[model samples]
Structure formats: structure tokens, C-alpha cells
Target: MKTYDILILGGGAAGFFTAINVAEANPRLKIAILERGKDVLTKVRISGGGRCNVTHACFDPDELVKFYPRGEKELRGPFHTFASGDTIEWFERHGVELKIEEDGRMFPVSDSSQTIIECFLEATKKCKIDVLTTQSVQSVYQGENHWKVDTNQEQFSCQKLVFATGSNPKMWELLQGLGHSIVEPVPSLFTFNIKDNRIKNLPGVSALASVNVNGTKFESAGPLLITHWGMSGPAILKLSAWGARILAQKNYQFGITVNWLHTSDAEEAEQILRDIKQNQPKKAVVSKSPFDFPNRLWESLVTASGIPSEQKWADLSKTQLQKLSTELTQSKFNVNGKSTFKEEFVTAGGIDLKEVNFKTMESKVLPNVYFSGEILNIDAITGGFNFQNAWTGAFILARSIS
Candidate 1:
């Protein structure tokens, strides 16, 4: 059987980061990455629509931890150790310049994920770290003072073993065999599917709004995009991440309230509507939208409020005004299902967080065993936050190993 000082499973972001950092810290130690698929860094190549959201612009560790719905408390200390600023400096030193977008998402100046992938590949080659692909892990266990991992190709052992395989069920099962608790994976960062007239033919229509999963405390406020399937964007994605478990328990069938005006108070919206009626009495209610959002959306809401297309603001009755106010401030929709956000898929479960040490990113249940990335019960909403989590954990784990 072949052997190495370090063996990292999963050649994705976390795995690659850990391997490269470990090799850099301990140049004399032998290291290898075992990848199941023929291609490594597939997720990195496709993230951010091929742009590769390297990290978010948030530099504060306290604020950065807020993005992660699951790993918030546990990651507080780790982020302080290696946050977004550290990530930027690391990439800069590696000859990859990162630029921050208006939305606070940082991407390579090249705007191509290939740049990031190529950088990783070059680093591995330079560090003499073996990146063995198509080596699916069969089983892994501790033996004497080393960790033994059997794969489809061959058997390998290492003094330090790391599992960065994000959301792999087979790996979770293997970990469970070794006395680790799996959190039962569930879908996170998904868009709601709703077939509603208010949103029909309104694909791509986006606005700043507040959304709440009806009958629950899960609520978010941000830019909500009306998609062909239903609603998406930061507002909905935040709610989806924060409520992943609860929504899964409900079987993805639930009700939600959309505050079109970005506020929950219907009375406040009603007062604004009354003022509009008094100021623009002769103007057709559907002719122009009084709000800052898209007029097409306003027209749809007006029609849904039982107002005639040609009806002027002067002819609006009290009930019609009230209905319009409610529709504007608190429109309700029944979500029947969900759709994955673009090509990105994240999960809300993995090895339980309690089983790992955040400071060292080492397994508390087993010595010399480490985990990083989604293998732990940690995930964040969209926007480069997930990648940041991977970097932070991998860096900390690499330090511990070295």
C-alpha cells in the first residue's frame, strides 16, 4: 500500500486549499489529494456563473459570520483568524487579483473561474502535492497511529487525514462508521416555485421587498426577483438558507407573504395610496406606478386588486383602495415547490458541528482527522459567503496540520 504524511479527500475548494496551504507550511511533508471524479474543482469552475465568487468584501469577522445561517456561532473565532481580507491578500500573493462588485461579491479581475482553477493547479504542481483523480474513496478507518483510506484505485494511509468532500453521502456514512454523527442533508439556497397571476409573465422583474414564510418567524428583506418559476434573489435566498430545515420538514409546501413596498404595515401603505388618489385623481391607476419598482409589477398588483385597467384614481372606492394597499404591502402566495439556484446547490446538513473543533478544524471524536467546508453542518446564503467559509476552515485546518 502507498502512504503519505497527509491525505485530503475531495479536491474541491476546501480540499485544494487545505492541501496547498499544508504543503506551503511544511514543504518537506508528502501530501496528496484523492478526488472521486475525473475533474477537480468542478464547483469552483461553475460558481458565480463561471466568474468564481472568490469571497465577499465583508472584512469584519463579526459581520462576516452573519452570512452563514448554520455555522454563525462556531465560525466567529475562525473568521477573525482568516477572514475575507486575509483571503484577498493570499490570492494577491499567488498572482490572482480579485475585484469586488457593487453587491460586495469579490471575483477575479479576469472574471473567469479558469484563472482560479489554473492557479490552484499550478500551486499543486509547484508544491509537489499529488492530485490523484478518479480515486473514489471506498472506506476509511483509523489504524494504530495512522489513518487508512481504501479507494477504488488503491489503498493509502496518512498521519493526518482531511475530509473536504462537500455533502457526499457515502463519505458521511463512512464517517458515521467511525463514530461521527451525520446531520441528514437537506437542500439549502433554493428558489420558491409558485404559479401565481401576479408573477406570471413577469420573469426577471425584480424589486426591493420584504418576504416572510407565513406562520413562521423566517423573514428577509432585500431585492426579490420575480423569476419564471417564482421568486428569488437575496431576499428569498436568505429566507431559504435560514429556514432550510423548517421548510424541509414542511415538505417544501408552504405559504409566504411578500411585502411589495418593502414594509409590513398595510396601514402605512394605505395612507400612501390615499395620498396618491388625492394627488392624481384624473390619472388612470394603471397608467403609471407611484412606487419606484417596475411598473409592470405595479400593473399586475393593481389588476389583482380588482381594479379595472382603465379605472382612474378618482373613481377608486374605499374597498378597492384597501385591497390595493394590502396587495402592495402584504401579498400572499402559496409555494408548491422549489428550484435549485442556478447551477449552484448547497446543503444544510453534514457531520454535526459539535464533533469538530473550530479553532483547529480537527475532528474532536478522532485524533489527526480533520474536516472543512460543507462536510460539516455549516452553510451560508448566496453571494461569495460559502467560498469564504471554505477558505477560512481550510486555512485553519492547514495550520493545525502543519
Candidate 2:
């Protein structure tokens, strides 16, 4: 059988990066990436609504690690080696320019995922890294000081094996057969699907709000969007990322409290509403909301608060004002289910981080084997953090292997 110095499974960001870096670092090393999918970087093409959020702009390694909800502890060491700054430099060195958005998300200057994909393809070609597509690895076995990889097409031998197959179950199963510990996988970064009139007609309405998941454990404040299905945006996505495990345990069924006004608390928000009612007492409640919420959203909130649109704030009693304040500030919604945050849904569990050496992403239990990317139990919040993990882990492993 033909032998290679490095064999990487999965042609996603991590695998391609590992192949390119290893080939560049060691010119004589024979590196091949085997991808089951017909097209490489399929997810990359669809990530970030097709803009491909390559990485976050956060430069501090410690700060960057906090974005990952799962592998924060394990990724601390890897981030020190290769973080967002490294990602920027690597892409720029290869001729792909990236720009950071106001929200700290970094995307290609071309605003096209094709830019990132072509850069990887060109880098791989320049480095002479072999890429095999439509090759599904069935299993992996250790051979004396080497690894025998069995695929649907054929079997190959490699001195080093790297699993970057993303969150695929079969990949984890293959690794488990090779005696690696894997954490049970679960969905992360999803939006809540709630059926409520409070946000029904106002599909595109969004507000800077604070979301408290059951008033404990997880909390985030950002742009909260009201979609036809339910709620989304930075606040909702952050909630999904942070409470991925807890929500999964609760079977995606839970109560979510939203502070639409983003005031300190219910009492504080109630005082603000009371002041508005007193100040704008002559105005119709629907025509003039206390906060700068959208007209449709304000009407919806008023309707949900059991107040008529024609009711004058001047005629509002203390109890009515308190009710409106409660509805505006601490509105509780039942999240009966979840829907994908577009096509960029990520999972939060994979190969347990404790079993892998973060310095090199190599398996501590098995020599000559490494793990990187989403294949491990590392998942981050939205805003390019997940892609950063892939780049960081792959870069570390490539350096160590080379």
C-alpha cells in the first residue's frame, strides 16, 4: 500500500488547513486530505449566510477562548499558539483579504465565500497537498508505528492520522473503535420557535434586549429579532450557544424571559413606563410607546399587555401601567421547540477535550493520531468563533506534526 506522512479525514476548513500548513512546513512530507463530500468546504460555502465568517477579530487569546462554550478550557493552550490574529495573517499571506464588521465578525473583503474556498484550493495546490474527494473512511486501525485507513474507495497507510470530520457520527464511531473517548453530541446555535402574537406580525422587528434563560445560568444582551417563526439574532444565538446543554437536557422546551426595554430590572423598567405614561399621558398608548420600539411591535406588545390601542396613557391606572411594564420588560415566552439559525447550525459535543493534548491536538491515549475542528467537543458562540477554533486547532497540529 502507498504510504503518506499525514492523512487527514474531512476536507473542511481544519483538514485543508492542516494539509496546507504541514506541506508548507515540511516540503518532503506527503500529506493527503480525504473528503467524503463531493465538494470540499461545503459548510464554509454556506456559513454566515454565504458571507463565510472566517474568524472573530478578537486578538487576545484568553478573550478568544471565552467564546467557545464547550472547549474553553482545552482551547486555552491552542489559542496561545494560533488565534484570530494568526488566522488573519494566514489568509492575508495567501492573498485573501479580510475585513472586520462593526460586530467584530471578520469576513473576506470580497464578501464572497468563493474567495476563502479558492484561497484554500490555491494554497493546497501550491503546497502540493493531495486532496481526495468522495472518499468516505470506513474505519481506522493502528499498524506498527503507522495507521491503516480504510475507505469506500481503497485503503491507505499513513504515519500520522488526523480526524477533522466535523461533527459527523460515523467519524466519532471510527475514532471510538480506535479507543478514543467521545462526548455525546448535541445541537447548538439554534433559534427558539415560539408561537405568540406578541411577535407574530412583526417579523423583522428587532430590539437591543436582555435575554435571561429561566432567570438563571445564562444571560445575554444584544439585538433580539422577532421573526415569523419566533426570535433570533445575537441575543438569541448567544442564548443558544451558552445554554446548549441545558436546553438539550430540557428537550428544547423551556421558558425564556426577555427584557425588551433592556432596563436594569422589572421595577426599573416599570418606573420608566410609569414616567412615560405620566409625561405622555395625553397620547394614545399604541401611537406613542415609551421606548423606541417599532410601530407594529409596539402595537403587538400593547395588545398582548391586555390594553386597547385607543386607551390614553393619561387614563392608565397603577395596575395597568405595571402590567404594561411587566409585558415590556420581563415578557416570558414558552419555547416549545427550536429551528436552525439558517444553515450554520453547530453542535456542542464530540471527542472529549480531556483525552486530547491541546498543545498538538493529538490523542493522549493513542500516539500518531490527532483531532481538530468540530470533530472535537469544542463549539463556540456565533460571530466566527467556531471557524477560529478550526483554524487554531489545525494550525497547532500541523506545526507539531511537521
Candidate 3:
């Protein structure tokens, strides 16, 4: 049996980072990364449309924790240890310069995920970390003072084992067999599938809007995009993360209320529409929408609201005007399902955070066993926050284990 000081059971961001940190911290300590997938960092290669959103620019630990829907309270301690600033510095030190966008999302200046992957590979190589591809670990066991890892290839022993296998069900089962409590996993960061023409044909059109899920409980305001299937972008993604559990409870079936104008209230938005109608009563409703919405979207919204485009605002009844106001300001759509955005899909639940020490991501129930990344019940919104959790968790565990 091959033996090492530490055995990491995944070669993604968390596994690689843990190996690099441990190796760098203790040169004599042997470390190996076992990855089941053919290619390492497959998700990283495809995340953020291949740009690899490294981290968010949010530096404050309190403010940063809010982005994570699952591990917000538990991640407070970990974020303080290694926040987004630490991530930026880590990448910068490794020869990959990252730039933050106006929306606070940080990406490599090279604008290629290869840059991040190459940097991780280079770091692993420099630290003398052994990476074995196509090695899928079937189970892990604790023996006296060491861990025995079983894989298809062979069995290995280690002083410590880190389960960085991400959100895979098999990985969770392996841990659960060893007496770890796992929070039921569910999909997060998905776009809503609304089969409505108001947003369908106007695919790429975006508007600054506020989305209120089921009138209350969850709300997010930002740039919203019209997709071929439904609505998306920052606002929708945020709503999805915050309401992930609720949506799952309802089987992804719910109604979404969109405040198109993003005004203070629906009454204010209605007043704005009323003023537009009064000023442009003679203008063709099809030709001129009350708001700055796209022409195609305006026509669709008008048609969906059952309002006649040819009818002058002066000739329209109070009921028709109220209906148009409802369609524009408080548009409600039936969300039948969910669709993944780009190549970025995240799971919301994993090993419960309470069972793991956030300071080091080490299991409180099991000694010398650590957890990190999405494998834990920690996930954030679409912006680089999720990746930041991986970095933060890995850093904490690596430091503790070393």
C-alpha cells in the first residue's frame, strides 16, 4: 500500500489548493491528489464562460458571508482567515493577475481559465505534490492513527485525509458510511424556466429590475436578462440561491414577481406609466412603450396583457389601464423548471457545517479528517463568491493540517 502524510481525494480547486499549501508548509510531508475525472479542474475550465471567476472583490468578512446561502454563519470564521483579498494576493503571487469588474466579480487579466489552471499546476509541481488522474476513491476508513483510502487502483494509507471530492453523491456516501452527517444535497444557482413570450423572443434584452419571489421571503435587485426560456442574470441568480430550499420544496414550481421599473413601489411605477400614457395618448402603443423596454418585449407584454395596441390611452378603460400597469410593474410568471447557466452549476447542501470546524474545516466528530469546498453545505450566489469559499476552506484546512 502506498502511504503519504496527507491524501486528498479530489483534484479540483480544493484538492489542489490543499496539497499546495500543505506541501509548501511542510516540505518533508508527502501529499497526493487522487482525481476520478480524466481532466483535472474540469469545472474550473468551464466556469464563468471559461474566464474562471476567481473571487468576489468583497473584502469585509461580514458582508462577504451574506452571499453564501448555506454556510453564511459558519463561514464567518473561515472568511476572516482567507477572504477575497487573500485570493487576489494568492493569484497575483502565482503570476496570474486578476482584475475586478464593476459588479465586483474578479477574473484573470488573461481572460482565460487556462491561466488559473496553469497556475495551480505550477504551484502543485513546485510543492512536489503528486497528482494521480483517473483514480476514483471508493471509500475511506480510519485505522488507529491513520486513514486507509480504497480506490479501484489500490489502497493507500495517510496520517490525514481530506474529502475535497466536491458535491458528488458517492463521495457523500463514502463519508456517511464513516459516520458523518450529510445535509441532503440540492441544486443551486440555476436559471428559472418560464414559458412566457414576454421574455422569450427578446432573448438577450436586459433590464434593471427587482425580483420578489412569492411576494415575500426572498428579494433581489439588479440587472435582469430575458432568455429564450425565461429570465436570468444577477437578479435571477441571486433569487435562485436565496430561495433554493423553498423552490426545491415546491419542486421548482413557483411564481416570480418582477418589478420591471425597479421603482420604490408598485404605486410609483403605476404613476410613471400613467404619466407616460397621458403624455403619449396619441402615440401608437405598439410603436412606443411606456418604459425603455425593448420594442419586441413591449409588443409581447402588450399582447400578453390583452390590451389593444391601436386603442388610444384616452380611449382605454380604467380596467385596461390597471391591467397594463400590472403587466408592466408587477409581471408574474409561472416557473415550471430550472436550467443551468453556462457551465456553472452549484449544489446547495452537503456535510452539515455544524459538524465541521469552520476555523480549520476539520471534522469535529472525526479526527484528522478535513472537508472543504462545495463538499460542505456551503454555496453562494453566481458572482465569484462560490469559488472564494473553496479557496477560504482549503486555506483553513491546509494551514491546520500542516
Candidate 4:
């Protein structure tokens, strides 16, 4: 049996971050990370379509926590300890320069996730931490002094154990065995699926939108995309995150009201339509797109409003104008289903945060056992926020786990 002072399960972002920081905090302690997969950091490699969004530009801990749907209150104190600013400085110190885009997502200047992976691997090597791949953990039980972990290849023991396995059903079973409550995992950050003809063949059309789940209080405002399947982009993704649990309860079948203009008042949209009709009577209703919307989408909206393509703006009746205004302001679509946004499938459930000590990210019920990343019931809207959670928890766990 291999024994180490510290054992970290699942060698993804959180696991590696914890292992590296722990080794740095205590150079004498031996640390090893056991990865079930043949490769490590697969998610990081594919995140942001291989660019790997490292962290967001939000520096304030209070403002930062707002992005998270779950664990917002729990992560408040932890973020103060190791937040986005610390993340930026940490990576910069490691020779991986990060550049923040206009949308506030920070990535390696090289625009490659490999830079981040290389930095971690080099840091671990410098710290002499052992990382074992293809080490699938089967069971975990606490011994009187150290933790006992049985794996497919071998048995291992450690003075401290950390699980960053991230949404793995088998790991949740292990956590349940260890007396930790596992919040039922549900899909988050998914795009709505609609078969409405208004968006058919309008895959590339996009506009700023405010999307709200009709019955729920959940809502989001940002750029919205008319995907080949349905709707996506920041607005839809944020709504998906905020309503992950409730929508799951509804079986992914729900109604969403979309404000394509993202404005609260429809009266302003009506005025814009009237002004267009008065000023450009000779122009086709679809000719000069208003509201800064894409030309194709304006055409689609006009068609949906029953406005004839060749009809002049001057020929619009009172009913046609009202219909056009409604379509622009509050276009309702039946969200019959959902589709994956990119390849990332974020979940809004995991180890219940109430059972975790935010100060150390250690289990309140179990000693010498810690968790980070998606293994915990913490998730956020699409962006670098998810990765930031992993960094914050792992850093705290590294410092607190003696």
C-alpha cells in the first residue's frame, strides 16, 4: 500500500491547485494526487473552447459572489481569502500572463489552455508532488488516525484527504458513505430548445435580451443567441443557472418570456415603431433594422408580426404596430426542451454547502477531509466564475488542512 501525508482524489483543476498549494505551504509534507482518468485537467483543457478562461475581472468579493447561483453566501468569506485578484497575481507569478477581454473573462495571453496546464505541471514538479493517473478510487473510509482509500490499482492511506472528483455519481456515493449529504445533481447552464418558426434557420441572429422564466423570479439580461436548437448566450445561460434546480423539478419543460430589446417598458418600443413608420414610409418594413438588431432577426420579427415584407411602413395599421411592438418587447417562445451549450455541462448540485466549513472547505462532519470544485453545491453563470470557485476553495483547503 502506498502512503502519503496527503492524498487528493481526482486530478482536475481543484485537485491540482490544492496539491500544489499544500506542498508549497508545507514543503516537508508528502502529497500525491490520484486521477481516475488516463489524463488530468481535461475540463481545463477544453474550457472556453481551449482558451481556458482563468478568472473573471471582478475583483470585489462581494460583487464576485453574485455570479454564483449556489454557494453565494458560503463563498463570501472564502473569496476574501483568495479571490480573482489573487488568482490573477498567482498565475502571473507563475509566468502565465492573463489578458482580460472586453467581457471581463481573463485568459492566458497565449490564448491556449496548455499554458495553464504547463504551469501547474511545472509547479507540481518543482514541489516534488506525485500525480498518479489511471487511479480510480472505489471506496473511502476513515481509519483511526489516517484516511483509508481503496482504488482499482492499489490501496492508499493519508493523514489528510481531499475530494475534487466533481459531479461523479460514484464519488457522491462515497461522500454519502462518509456522512456528507449530496444534493441531487441537476443540469445547469443549458440553452433553451424551441421549435418556433421565428427562430428557424436564424442560427446566427443575436441581440441583447432580458429573459425571464414566466413563473419564477429568475431572470437575466445579456447578449442572446438564436441557436440552431433554440436560444443561448449570456442571457439564457444565466437564467439556466439561476433556475437549475426549479427547472429540473419541472423536467426541463417550462415557458420563458424574452424581451429582445432588454427594456422593461414596451411603450418605448412602440414609439420607435411609430417614428419609423412616420419618417420612412416608403422604405420596406424590413429594410432599415431598428433596435440595433441584426437584419435577419428584424426580418424574422417583422414576418412573425404578420407585417408583409413589401409593405411600406406608412401602410401599417394600429393593430400591426401594436403587434410589432409586442414582438420586439416581449416575444414569447415555448421552451419545449434544452440543448448543451458548448461542451461544458455545469451542474448546480453536489456536496451540500451547509455541511461544509467555508473557512477551510473541510467537511463539518468529517475531519481531515476537504472538497473543492463542482463536487460542492456551488455553480455560476457561464464565464470564468466556475473556475474561480475551484481556485478559491482549493486555495483555502490548502492553507487550512494542516
Which of the predicted structures, 2 or 4, would earn the higher TM-score when compared with the native? 4
In candidate 3, what are the lDDT values of residues 1-402, reduced to their tens digit?
999999998899888988988888889999999999888999899988999999999999999999988888988888888999999998888899999899899999999999999999999888888899889887787799999988889999999999899989999987888788999987889899999767767889888888888846899999999888888899999998988888899898899898777764656756776786788777766676557666777788777768777866666666766777787778888999999877787988889888998777889888999997899998999889988999999999999989
Report the lDDT tens digits of candidate 2 across residue range 281-335.
Answer: 8899888555766777778878888888789988888888778778888899999
Q: List the residue pairs that clash in candidate 3.
A: none
Candidate achieving the largest TM-score: 1
**Residue ranges of candidate 3 with Cα displaced over 4 Å:** none
TM-score leaderboard ranking? 1, 4, 2, 3
> What lDDT does the true structure give each of the candidates?
0.95, 0.88, 0.86, 0.91
Off by over 4 Å in 2: none
Best by lDDT: 1
Where does candidate 4 clash, by residue pair? Answer: none
Predicted candidate 1 versus true structure: per-residue lDDT over 1-402, tens digit per residue = 989999999999999999999999999999999999999999999999999999999999999999999999999999989999999999999999999999999999999999999999999999999999999999898899999999999999999999999999999999999999999999999999999988998999999999999999999999999998999999999999999999999999999999988964889988988999999899999998889899999999999999999999999999999999999988999999999999999999999999899989999999999998989999999999999999999999999889
Off by over 4 Å in 1: none
Error of 1 at 60 (Å): 0.6
Candidates 1 and 3: which is better by TM-score?
Answer: 1
Candidate 4 global CA lDDT score = 0.91
**All predictions: root-mean-square deviation over Cα?**
0.8, 1.2, 1.6, 1.0
